[model samples]
Target chain A: MSRLSRFLKDNGISVVFGVGFLLSLIGQAFAGRAEFNEELQSDGARPVGFFEYVATSHFAVDITENWQSEYLQFFLFLFGTVWLLQRGSPESKEMHKAGLESDKDQRVGPHAREDSPRWAAVGGLRQTLYSRSLGIVMLTAFLGSWLAQSISGAAALSEERLRGLQEPVPWASYLLSADFWSRTLQNWQSELLAVGSMAIFAVYLRQRGSPESKPVGASHDATGIEG
Target chain B: MRTIARLAVLTLVVGVPLTGCAVPQDRLEAVRKATERFATLHTAGDFRAACALLTSAAREEAVHNGGPTCAQALADAELPEPGAIRSTDVYGRQARVELATDTYFLTSFPGGWRISAAGCTPREGRPYRCLLKGD
Candidate 1:
C-alpha cells in the first residue's frame, strides 16, 4: 500500500475522533449561541454575534467544565491501571502480572531491545519519565482544565449575579460555591460511572474483532485476554 | 513537545480570557456616560429622555406597572434619588454601576448600556430588590 494509505489506515481512529471533536465543537458553538441569544433577548440585551458569543464567559465555562471532566476521567483511568486489576476485564492488567511487572517485561535498561525507544535503552531518569509520560500528561491536562473551569465558571457566575442584580462573588469565594462543585462533580460522576461500567461489562462481554474485549470464544473468567 | 501550541490554546481559552474582558478604558466610559445621563435626565424631570435609557424589558415593566406611557410610569415609580456614580463593574454584556445612594443594573444593548434595573438594594442570600426592575 502507498504511504498515504498506510498512514490513513494506521491513524484512522485518531483522525476519526479528531474530526468528530471539531464537528461537535462547531455544532456546540452554534447551539450555544442560539440559546445565549435567547437569554440575551429575554434580558433585553442585544443578541451577540457568533464569535462574540464564543468569547463570552458563558461559553468558556461550558466548554472547560466538560474538558476538565474528560481529562480527569482519562487521567484516573491511565494512572489507576498500573496497580489495579479486574479478573476478566481487558481494561485491567492481568491479575498475576500486576504491580509494574518485571524490568524485562517493560524492556528498560539492559533488557531494552534494539527497536526500543531511546529513553528505554538509555535507561534512567529519561526512561522513568518516558514510562510514565502518558499518565503525567493526562494528569496535567486534568489539572489545567480544572483550573480553567474554575476561572471561567466564577466569571460566568459573576455575570449571572450582575444580570440578576446580585453582587458578583470573588473567584476565591466561588471556589467554595455550590455552582462550581455541581459543575465539577456532576461531570466527574458521569465519567467515573462510564469507565467503571465499561471495565466490568468487558468481563462478560465479547467483541469479536475489537481489542477492547475478549475473543468471542474466550472464557468469561479469562483475565486480560484481548481479541 | 508542542508546549507553545498548548500554551497558546490555554491563554486564548483554557484559562479563558472570556469574562470581564475589561476593555475598561472605553466601555467603562460608555457605562458611566449612559448611567450619568439617566441620572441627570431623571433629576431634571425629563422622564421621557430618562425612560429612553432603560432596557426594553425595564421599559416594558414600567409600562405594565404604572403606564399609559414609559415616561409616566417612570414618574410614578418614584425610584430613589440617584447620586454621583461610584463604580462600574462591566462583565461581557452586563454591567453593575454603584451610585452613592443606589445601585443600577445595566445591559449592553446595540444602543449601549441601558438600565435594566435602578434603585436596587442588596438582600442577603437573595437577588437585589430593585424599585425599577425589568420584567
Candidate 2:
C-alpha cells in the first residue's frame, strides 16, 4: 500500500494523461463512424465500413483540428507566461519581473545544483536555447498540427465538392477561402477562452492536492511560487 | 378612398414585371451531360479527363487531393463504376433521375440540368428506401 502510494505520487499525471488520451481516441472513432453514416444516408450513398472511413481525411481533419487547438493553448500559455504576469495569480510570475531572468536566478554553470541538467551547466547558447525548449517544442507541434488541419481540411472539402458535382478549388484558394479560416477560428476561439479562464481562475482557486493549484489556505495575493 | 383605389391600381401595374425568367430545360440537359461526362471519365479511371468535367466545387476538392489528377475515389480503394441515366423526371428547374446504379438529384445551372447530388447503394437493401429518384 505504501509503495503504491509512492508510485502514484511520482507518476500520477503521466498515467492519467496517457489513459485519457487513449479513451478519447476510441470514443472519437465510434462517434465519427456514426456521423459518417448519417452523411452517407443523406447522400444516398452506402454506409462505409468503420475502418474505411477511419483512413480518410475526414477522420484525419477531425483529430488534427482538436490536436492543433490543444497545442496552440499550451504553446501560447508557455510563451505568454514569460512576457505577461498577474500580480496576485499563482498561475503567473510577478508583474515587475517579466521576461527572461538572470543566469543565477535560473541556475547555470558553477551556480547550478548537483542535479541540474548538463545543458544548464554548460552555459553559452546551449543553455540559453535550452531555457526555452518547452515552449519551442509546444510551438513546433502547434504549427505542425495547424498545417495538417489545412491539408486534411482541403481533402475533406474536395470530397464534398466532388460529391456535389461541383468543381474543386486549388489548395491555395481553399486555404484562403472563408471555409478554412472559419474552421480554424472557431476552434481557436474556444481554446483561447479556456486558457484565459485557467489563468484567471487559478489566482484565487485551490484544488487541494493538485499541483495545478496552490495550497487550500494559500493567500489570494501569493504569486509565482507553487505550494 | 379614391386615392387608395388609385394606389392599388398602380401597385398592380408594377407587379406585372417583377417575375423573373425561369431556367430553361435545355440548359439543364447540358449541365447533366457535363456531369455525366465527368462521371464517365472517373469510372474509366481517366481522372484528368474527369477532373476537367468537374463543376467548380468538385474541382476544388480534386485539387486539394494532390493535383486534381488522380483517379482515387471515396478515399477508399473501392472504385465506383460509371453509369448512364436510365430515366429522368424534370419539373421546372429541378429534376431527379434514375441512373444504372444510383439516383441523382439535379438542379438547373446556367449550362443545363446538372446533378446537384447523387447517392449510391447496393442492389438489395437498395437506395430506394430513402431516395426520391423514380415515380
Candidate 3:
C-alpha cells in the first residue's frame, strides 16, 4: 500500500473519530451561537461573534459535561468489568475467569514475554501501577473533565444569574448547588444507561466483523467470545 | 499515548481556571470606577449625567417606567444613597457592584461600563427587583 493508504489503514479509527469530533464541535458552535444570539436579542444584549461564543463558559460547560460523562462511562466499564461478570456477554470475561487472574495468566514478571511492556516485565510499584494503568487513566480523565465541567458550568450559570440581576455565587457554592449536580447526574444517567444496555444487548446481538460483538454463528450462551 | 494523556490532563488542569471566573483586574477596576461615577452623578442630582452613564436600553426603560425622559424618570425615582462599594463580581460583560446599602448592575459596551440597574433588592429565588432596571 502507498504511504497514505498505510497511514489511513493503521490510524483509521482514530482518524475517523477525530474527524467526527471536529465536525460535531463545529456544528455545535454554529448552532449554539445562533441560539445564544437569539437569547441575547430577546434580552436586549448584542449578539456575540462565533469565536467569542466558543470562548464563553456556555460552550465550555456543554462540551466538558458531555466529555466528563463519556470518560465516566469508560472508567466505570473498565473497573467494573474487572470485578463484575456478565455471563454470556461478549463485553465481559468468561464466567470462570472473574477477578485478577494469576501472574502466569497475566504473563508478568518471570512469565513476561520479550514483547511485554517494560513495567509489566519488572516487579515493583511500577508493575503494580501498570497493572491498573488503564483504570487509573480512565479515572483521571473522568475526574479532570468533571472538574472542567464544574468550573465552566459555574461560570456560565453565574453569568445567567448576573443577567437576571441576581447575586452570582462563588465557584465553591456553585459546586455544591443543585445546578451542578443536576447537570452532572443528568448526563451521567444517560451514559450509564447506554453502557448497561450495550452490555446486555451484546449478550444476544451479533455483528459480523465487529470485535465488540460475538460472531454471527457464536452460541448465545458462549461467554467472552468476540468476532 | 502517555504524552497525549499528559497533555490532556495538563490542558484540563490549566484550562478550567483560565476559562472559569476570570475577571481581569483592569476590567474590575474600570467597572468599579464606572459604578463610582454613576453614584456620584446620581447622588449629586445630575440626573442627565447619570442617565448618560446608563445603557441605552436602561435609559429607554427608565423613561418608559416613569417620566417622559430618562433624567426625569431617574429624578422622580429618588434612588437611595449607594454608599461605599463592598464587593464586585464580574462575569464576562456583566458585573454586579455590591454597595453598603444596595447593589447595582452594569454591562460593558464598546465605550465603557454602563449602569443597567440600580437600587436593586434581592427577591428570594428570583431576579433582583431593581428600582431602575433596564428593559
- Give the winner by TM-score: 3
Report per-candidate DockQ: 0.42, 0.02, 0.66
Model 2: residue A206 alpha-carbon error in angstroms? 2.0
The TM-score values for the models, in the order shown, are 0.86, 0.62, 0.94
Candidate that would win on DockQ: 3
Give candidate 3's whole-model lDDT. Answer: 0.89
> What's the lDDT for candidate 2?
0.63
- Model 3 lDDT tens row, A128-208: 999999889888878988888888888888888888788887889988999899989999999989999988999888889
The TM-score measured for candidate 1 stands at 0.86
Q: What share of the true interface contacts does candidate 3 keep?
A: 0.62
Candidate 1 lDDT, B2-46, residue by residue in tens: 896577556644346445333558998999999999999998899
In model 2, the runs with Cα more than 4 Å from the true position are: A1-9, B1-135
- How many angstroms is residue A131 displaced in model 3 relative to the true structure, after the best TM-score fit? 1.3
DockQ score of candidate 3?
0.66
Find the candidate with the highest lDDT and give its number.
3
lDDT per residue for candidate 2 within A39-77, as digits (tens), equals 856854446577766655677778778777888899988
